[model samples]
Every structure is written in structure tokens, then in C-alpha cells.
Target: MMQLFRHLRLGMKIGGGFTLILLLTAGVAVIGVRGLTSIGTTVTLTTETNRMAHEALSARAQEKDALLRGEAQTITQTQQHITAIGQQATTTKEKIADPTINEQLGAVVAAAGDYAKVFQQATEVRQQQTAAEEKMAQAAETLVKMAQAIRESQYQLLAEIQEKTQVAIQANRANVDDVSQIIQGIMQLRLTEEQFRLQRDAQTQAQVDSRHAAVVQLARNLQARLQTARNSVGTQVNDGMEDDAGLDIHTLAEQIIDLLETHHAGFTLYATELTEQLQAETEMAKQARLLEEQAERIRADQQQEFAALQQLQHTRPEVRNATLANVQATEQFIRGVLTVRLQEQRFVQGADAQA
Candidate 1:
């Protein structure tokens, strides 16, 4: 091959040399173009990755702010931002060469979606809590009204009892002492009932029951005396004995007996009313306690959710601290509300104030 090349014309050799040079130059150009294209692609990928990272970081900041502030508008803004970040991540994952990076992007998208759902749930829970608190306040107000009505009724019944006792005393002059004793027994019963309502202890309740029995016995004795007087008066009338004012002693005795029976009936009605009022108060207290327990359970659930959120890998230290503080504050506020409700319930039920 060297002998054949040496025998070639000089012009042909020069043309061959030029052709070889041109081929070498074309090859170098192709390699340089390929290198430039690769560098441009790498730069674009890096820029997109950086932008996505920055967007993700911004979304995280917004999420933390939204959670700390607990505002609907802020949460909505955070959700929008997260959605945008997720879309960007989805697009970036398609471009990413590494499978691990794509997986990380997918994780970020899922985490952002979870955060949004969690925020929505938290908002709903807060709304439910607010409604429950309002209902509790309304229940407390209703209890107060019921207590006031019961107290007013008691006062009215007591007044009526006093008026009836005075009428009995005036009507039965011959049995005035017995009537007075009945009145005194009724007054003692009233006092015992008041003590029971105030103390609400077993001893006070026993005293009230004893006083009621004494009052009933006194009423029975007065009734027996009135019956004896009525029989005696009837016998006198049959014997033609009448009062100086031309009033029939038999009719007077009958009127007195009727008044005594009416007074006893009134007392029985008052006792029934008092029992019903006490039962109503007990039921109200039970309902209030149940509402308080429900509120406490909801608060506990909220605290547990906050703790779970804090434990997430994406949760920042600052956000965790803020969440903890918010939880403590909410607990303290709820405790104060519960204490007030408990006191109100105790007041309505006539339970021990100290307890």
C-alpha cells in the first residue's frame, strides 16, 4: 500500500490530505456539539430541581404558618400552594433520571396532600368543638332558668301554705293550739327542706324526712281533733244547741274540717312539686356532666392528633413547639370552662359547693 501511495500524483495526495483533515474536523465538531447539548441538559435539570426544592420549602413554610395560626384563609392558601408544588413535582419527576429522586418527589406530593387533608379535618373538628361549646353554654343557661323557676315555685308554695295555715287558725278558734302546732310543724318541715337543699347531705335529708313525718303526724292529730270536735258539735246541734250569733256550730265544725283537709292536700301537692323539682335538677346535672365528658373527649382527641402531627418527619421543630403550646392553652381553657360548668351543675343540683 505504501508503494501504491508513493506512485500517486502530488495533487491527488494533497486532495486526499485535505479530505482527511475535513473528516477529522467534522468528527471534532460533532463531539463538541454533543458535549454542549449534554451540558445544557444538565444545567436545565439542575435549575428545575432547585426551583422545585425552593417551591417545596416555601410550601412547607406556608403549611407551618397555617397550622400555627389556624386560619381558614391561610390554610386555603397553603393548600393551593401545596397543590401547585405537587403538580410541579409531578412534572419534575417525569424529567428526573434517577428513580430515587422521582420517588422522593412522589413522597413530597403525598405528604403535601396529607397535610391538606389533615388541615381540613382539623378545621372541621374546631367547628364541631365550637358548636359543642355553644350548646354547653346554652344548657347551662337553661339549667339556671330551671333552678330559678323551682326556687320561685317553692317560695310561692310556701306563701300559700302560710296563708292556708292562718285561715285554719282563724276558722278553728277552739282548736287554735292544735292548728298552731300544725303550722309550727309545717314551718319546721320547710326549714328542714331548706337545709336539705343547701347541705344535700344524708344527715340533712334524714332531718327533712323526719320533719315531713312529724308534720304529717301533726296534721293527722289535728284532723282527728277536728273530727272529734265536729262530732261533738253535731251532737250538740241535735240537742238544739246553737251559737249566740245564730251561727250553726255544726256548720262551723264542717267548715273547719274542710279547711284542715284542704291544708293537708296543699302540703301534699307542695311535697310532690318539690320532689319533681329535685328530680329535674338531678337530670339536668347528669346531662351537664355528660356534655362536659363529651367535650373533654373531643379535646383529648384533638391533643392526640396534634401529637401525631408533631411526630411526622416533615414537621419542623418550631411547628411542633407551637402546636404543643396551642394544645396546652386549649386544654387550660377547656378545663376552666368545664370547672365553671361543674360548679353551675352543682349549684343547680344543690350538691356540695366545695366538692
Candidate 2:
């Protein structure tokens, strides 16, 4: 093989060498193109992940704001935000090259979903609580009115009893002082009963019971004193007039108390429900925050990946530049070699590598 190569003519050897260099240059170009292509793909993935992650973060923020408003009217808006976040997560997942980032993004999607469900439930419960509170307020107003009516009825009864007792006093003027004092006590007792009606639950139920008992006792005393006076003086105490008023007042008072108690019980129960909803909302908010934080972490990861890709993108150009320089140098060297070969061929006429 050495003897045959040595016997070749100069022109033939030059042609063979040029052909080999050409093939080598072509191979290098192919390799460079393949490397640049891979770099371009990494850059694309990084850019897509960055864009999707930004969108997801924005959507998550909007969802949080909607939840903060705590208004049922915003539920649809909140749902839309969550949906947008989910879509972003899906898109980002596709674009993310790193398995760790992809998995974390999936967790963000799941947490967002959980938050969405609980947030909707909380809003619905809040609406229910609002409605229940309105009803309770209305009932409370009605109870106040009913209690007022009972007070007025009691006043009317006291007036009638006093008037009946006064007739006996004038007829038996000797006992006028004693009867006058009793009438005065009856008026004072009616005033005290008014206090009971006005009393609130700031005091315990026992206090309320005590006041209620006192009112009953005072009413009874007034009725008894009036009856004794009527029996002694033979004064016609129209039994039906006082009986009907007292009975009506008692019945109405009981109803007012019942309503007030019902309102309180309803308030406690509804408030408890509202409290539970609030706690649930708080928990969901925390999960949403965690999801948001995780999305941010993913975004950060994407940014880091993008930085690395940018560096790789820079290296690709450098590699291309280096390859171009090598090709240019090789071309210049080949041209010099061809010029030398031409001179030699002209000077040593008809000489070739084949001998």
C-alpha cells in the first residue's frame, strides 16, 4: 500500500486529500447543526414554561382575591380563576422538561382543585348564614313589638283595677289611706313589670326567671288586694274585664318570651355554622397559598432552566463561530496547497500522483 501511494502522481494525491478534507468539513457542519438544534429545543421549552408559569401565578392570585371578598356573587369569578390556573398547570406540565418540576406542578394543580371545592362550599354556607341572620333580625323586631303590646295591655289592666278599687275607697272613706297605699303599690308593680319586659339576656336566664317570678307575684298581689277590697266593700269588680286583660297579657308575654328564646337559639346555631364555614375557608385559603407558593417555586425553576438554556444558547453560537473559523482556515490552507500543486505541475509537466 505504501509503495502504491508513493507511486501516485502529485495531482492525484492533491485531489484525494481535498476530497478527504471536504468530507471532514461536512461531518463537522452536520454535528454542529445537530448540537444547535438541541440547544434551540431547550430554549423553546424554557420559554414556554416561563410563560405558562406566569399565567398560572396570576390566576392563582386572582383566585385568592375572590376568596377574600367572601361574597357568594364572586363564586363564579373565583371558579373561572381556578380553571385558568388549572389550564396553565396542564400547559406548563407539558412544557417542563424536568421531572421534579413537573411533579410539583401537578401537586399545585391538585391543591388548587381542593381549595376551589372548599371555597365554593364556604361561600354557599356564608350565603346561608346571611339569610338566617336576616330572618333572626326580623323575628327579633317582631318580638320587641309583641313585648311592647303586652306592656300596654298590662298598663290597661292596672288602670282598670285601680279604678275599681277607688270606688270602694270613696264608699268606705274610713279606710281611704290603706286603699290608696295599695293602689300606689299596684302602679309601682306595673312599672317594675315593664322593666322585666325591657330586660335583655346580658344577664343570665336565672336573672330573667327571677324577674319574671317577681312580676307574677306582684300581679297576683295586686289582684288579691283588689279582690279583698271588692269583697269587703261589695264593690262590683267586673271580673271579666280584669280577667280577660290579665289572661291576654300573660298569653302574649309568654309568646314574646318564646319568640325571644327562639331567636337566641337560632342565632347561636347559625353563628356556629358560620364559624365552622369561616374555619373551613381559612383552611382552604392556606392550601391555596401553599399551591400558589408551589407554583412560584415552579416558576423559579423554570427561570433557572431558562438561564441555563440561555447559556447553552450562547455556547451554540460560540460553537458555530469556532466551526466557521476552522472551516475558513481549512479552506485557506487547501487553496495554498492547490496553488503550490499547480506551480509544481506546471514546472514538472505531466507529473501526477499515479507516476
Candidate 3:
């Protein structure tokens, strides 16, 4: 029991010694690790705080520079504005004091106003002048048309008169040829004096009877035609009076009557001679054709030649002259009026331009 107790005490001493050694080593290792961790954390926190401080300083410096530049720019802009205001004031003073410049400006303003008014008046006057010119031109054109119409009407009237005159002349020519042929036939028959007397008496009586009937009929026909011509002439004169704005229709009518009178006697004589000649020609042709048909053909040929001679009389100068004179007179009157109107228009235009 004594040995066991001692052994236990020694074992306890040994175990306590080992436990103390282990506790000492473990406490030293824990303190060393904690010291290292605290040192590393302190160094890292210091570096981060230093970097943040440097950034704050740089930001403050940049803010100061921006504020300085903004102040300088504001000062320069204000100075420039003040200088510009001074220049404007100086220029205003100079303009207000210069008499010649002020006068010139006033003159320019007045001139502009006057020019506007003058331009308006000029435009109005030009329009009026143009309208007047157009009206004058239209009037002149109307005159020209009237003149042309008058000329044509006069020409037609003269041509108709000339045709009538030519017809009278042709009839006279036919009568003369027929009378000559009748005389020639009588002479060529070679009848004895007694036979000639007896044949002449019979022929004269027959011719007298035929001539009386033909003359009565011709007189009746001529009277009717004369009445118709008179009615037509009266109607034409009235129409001419209405149509001719400036012509003397009474004088024209008198001239027409004179022309008719000039051909009247010749026309009557021609008809009488033509009738006698035709009667003699028929007798001669019958007498000659009783023996031969060839003689009848020859007589017919002579009649045709006489008819052709009458047609040629229509080409006389008197007929053409009458037509030309009437047309020229009417044309001259129209042209003269138109020319005068044109001249008046030109004069008015010139006056307008001067005004």
C-alpha cells in the first residue's frame, strides 16, 4: 500500500509537468499569430486611408482650378461687353451730330416715298395710255373694214353698170351688122327695077306689120323691166344711204342715171336695127335654102359670126374705167379716215409720254 501511494504521487508529478509544458507552448503560439494578424490589418488599413486622402486632395485642387478659370472668363466677357457698349454709344453720338449724313438719310427716305408714289402714278398713266392706244387701233381697224366694204360694194355696182353698157353696145353692133346684111342682100338679088319695086313693097308691108308687133311686145317687156330696175335702184339707193356713213348717195344716184341715159338711145336703135336685119335675114335664108340645104347652113354660119361680134363689145375700156373709179373713190375715203385716226392716236400718245 505504501509503495502504491508513492508511485501514484510520482505519476501525478510527471503528468502535471508534461501538462504545464504543453500549456506554455500553446499560449505562446496563439499570442504570436494574433500579433501578426493585427500588424497586417493595421498596415492594410493605413494604405487604404492614405490613398483616400490623396484622392480627396486632388479633387479639391481641380475644383479650385475650375473656379479660377470660370471667374477669369466671366471678367473677360464683362470687359468685352462694356467695351462694345462704349463703341455703340460713340457711334450713336457721331451719327446724331453729323448734319450732312442726317440730311442725306432724310433725303433718301423722302426720295423713296416719292418714288413709290411716282411709280404708282406712272403705272396708272401707262395703263390708260395703253388702253387708249388699243381703242384707237380698234377704231382704225373698223375704218379699214368699212372702207374695204365700201370699195367692194362700189366695184360691184360699177361692174353691173358696165355690164349693162356693154350689153347695149353689143346690141347696137348686132343691129348695125344685120342692117348692113339686109342692104347687101337686096343689092345682090339683082331684081329688075319693077320687080324690085313690087318685091320691096310687099317686103316693106310685111316688115312693117312684123316690126309693129315686135315693137309693141318689146315696149311692153322693156316697160316691165324698167319698172323692176327702178324698184331695184330705189331699194339700192335707200340701202346705200343707210350703209354709207360718210358718202353722198344723191350724187351717186345722179351719176347712175346719167350712165343709164348714155346707153338708152343706143340700146333702142340697136334693137330696132337688129329686128329689121333679122327679118331680112330670115327671108333671105328661106329663099336661098329653098334651092339647097347647103345655102341654109351658110346663112346659119353668118348668124353665128354676128352673134360672136356682139360678145366682143363687152371688153371696152369704158366699162372697166367705170368700175375702177368707183372702187378707188371708196377706198381713198376709207384710207384717209384711217390715216387721220392713226395720226391722232400717235399725237395723243406722244402727249401722254411728255405728261
Candidate 4:
């Protein structure tokens, strides 16, 4: 081969050398171009990764904002942002050549999906809590109105009882002793009724029942005495007393009986109303307890979700912070519900108007 090259013509040898050099230069240029192309691709991938990271952080910020604002529109916006990030991550992962990077992107997509799902669940629970709170507030308002009505009824009944007692005493002046006894019994009944109104317990109810029975008996005795007096007046009339005096006594006795009967009927109705009010209060207490329990359940669920999020591996700091903010917001909401329940209890069981 060396002898052949040595014996070749000068021009041919130079042309061959030049051709070789050109081929070598072309190979080198191709290699350099490939390297530059690879570097550009790497730079592009890096820029995309940085953009995805920025998007993730922005989505996390939106999540926190949604939690702080507690608005449905904000929450929906946050969810959409997270979904977009997840989609971008998926697209980027397909382009990634490194298996490890691809896996990391997959983890990010999973985390975003989890966050969106959990956030949606939390939003649903928050809505339920709001509905429950509204219901509790409505019940409380109704209970307050019922209490006002009961108080008004008590006052009206008491006034009626006092008026009837005074009328009975004035009408039966001759039977003052009987009237006094009847008045005493009525006063005792009123005292027991007031006690029942204040306490609304079985013991106080029993006292009221006993007092009612005693007043009924006293009223019957007074009626019998009035009947006797009426008969005596009739006998006196038959024996020559003034007819006008006898008629007046009879009319007064009838008036006293009518008043007693009317007052007794009113008291019976008042007792029935008291029983109904008591039942209403009991139902209100039960509803309040149920609302409190629901609030507790919501709080527990939020805590459990927070714990689950904490346990997740490779979670971004932004996602973790957003989770914590959501938990805190849920806790605040639960505390408000508990406060409302406390107020309901006070309204249901407390005797004072301040309650």
C-alpha cells in the first residue's frame, strides 16, 4: 500500500489528501452540531421543569387563598389550577428521558390529584356544616319565639287568675271566709305554676299538679257553699225576706261560679301549653346535641385528612403548607359551630333571659 501511494501522481495524491481532510472536517462538524443540539434540548427541559415548579407553587397559593376565603368560586378556581398543573406534569413526564425524573413527576401528579380530591371533600363537609349551622340558628330563633310566647301566656294566665279571684271575693262578700280560702288556694296554685314555669322539671310539675287539685277542691267547696247560701236565701224569701236581696245574692253566686269555672278551664289550657313547651324544649336540646355531634365529626375527619397528608412521602412544601391551612380553617369552622351549640344549650336549659 505504501509503495502504491508513493508511485501515484502528485496531483492525484494532493487531491486525495484534500478529500480526506474535508471528510474529517465534516465528521467533526456533525459531532459539534449534535452536541449543541443536545445542550439546547437539555436547556429547554430545564426551563420547562422550572415553569412547572412555578405553576405548582402558584396552584398551592391558590389553594391557600381558597381556604382563607372560604368561597365556592375560589375553591373551584384552585381546583382547576391544580388540575392544570397535574396535566402539565403528565405531559412533561412523557417528554422526560430519565426514569427517576419521570417518577418524580408522577408523584407530583398523584399529590395534586390527592389534594384536589381531599379539598373537594373538605368543601362538601364545609357546606354541610354551614347548612347545619343555619338550621341550628333557625331552631334557636324558633325556640326563642316559643319561650316568648310561653312567657306571655304565663303573664296573661296570672293576670286572669288574679282578676277572677278579686271578682269572686267582691261578689261573695257574705261568704268572705270561703272566698278567702278559695283565694288562698288560688294563690298557692299560682305559686306552683310560677315554680313550674321557672324550673320546668318533674318535681315542680308535681307541685303544680298538687296545687291545681287543691284549688279545684277549694273551688268545689266554695261552689257547694254558694249553693247552700243560695238555698238559704230562697228559704228566707219563702219566709218573707225582700225578693230583691235574694235575687241579688243568687245572681252574685252565679257570677262567682261562672268565674271559677272559666278560670279553671283557662288554667287547664295553660297547663297543656306548658307541657307542649316542655316537649318543644326537649326536642330543641336533642337537635342541638345532634348538631354538635356533626360538628365534631367534621373536625375529626379534617384531622384525619391532615394526618394522612403529613404521612405522604415526597410531598412538596407548598402542598404541605396548603394542607395545614385547610386544616386550620376547618378547625376554626368547627369551633364556631361548637360555640353556636353552646349558645343553643344556654337557650334551651338556662332560666335567665340572658341565655
Better of 1 and 4 by TM-score: 4
Question: Model 1: how far is 109 from its true place, Å?
Answer: 38
- Root-mean-square deviation (CA) per prediction: 29.8, 30.7, 64.4, 28.4
Provide the clashing-pair count of each candidate structure. 0, 7, 0, 0
Q: Show the lowest summed lDDT stretch of 10 residues, model 4.
A: 21-30
- Root mean square deviation (Cα) for candidate 2: 30.7
Error of 3 at 286 (Å): 99
Q: Looking at candidate 3, what is the lDDT of residue 114? A: 32
Error of 4 at 344 (Å): 3.6
Top TM-score hit: 2
Q: After superposition, how far is residue 116 of candidate 2 from its true place, in Å?
A: 2.5
TM-score each candidate. 0.33, 0.47, 0.22, 0.41
Show where candidate 4 strays beyond 4 Å.
1-174, 216-247, 310-318, 345-355
Model 4, range 70-185, lDDT digits (tens) per residue? 69888878677667756876886677566555665666566556546555644554455445434433433442343233234333333444545564334344244444554565
lDDT of model 2, residue 30: 29
Q: How do all the candidates rank in terms of TM-score, highest first?
A: 2, 4, 1, 3
Write candidate 1's Cα lDDT for 55-99 as tens digits: 433443454345335577887776676566557667766765555
Judged by lDDT, which candidate is best? 4
Instruction: Give the TM-score comparing model 4 with the true structure, all chains together.
Output: 0.41
Better of 2 and 3 by lDDT: 2
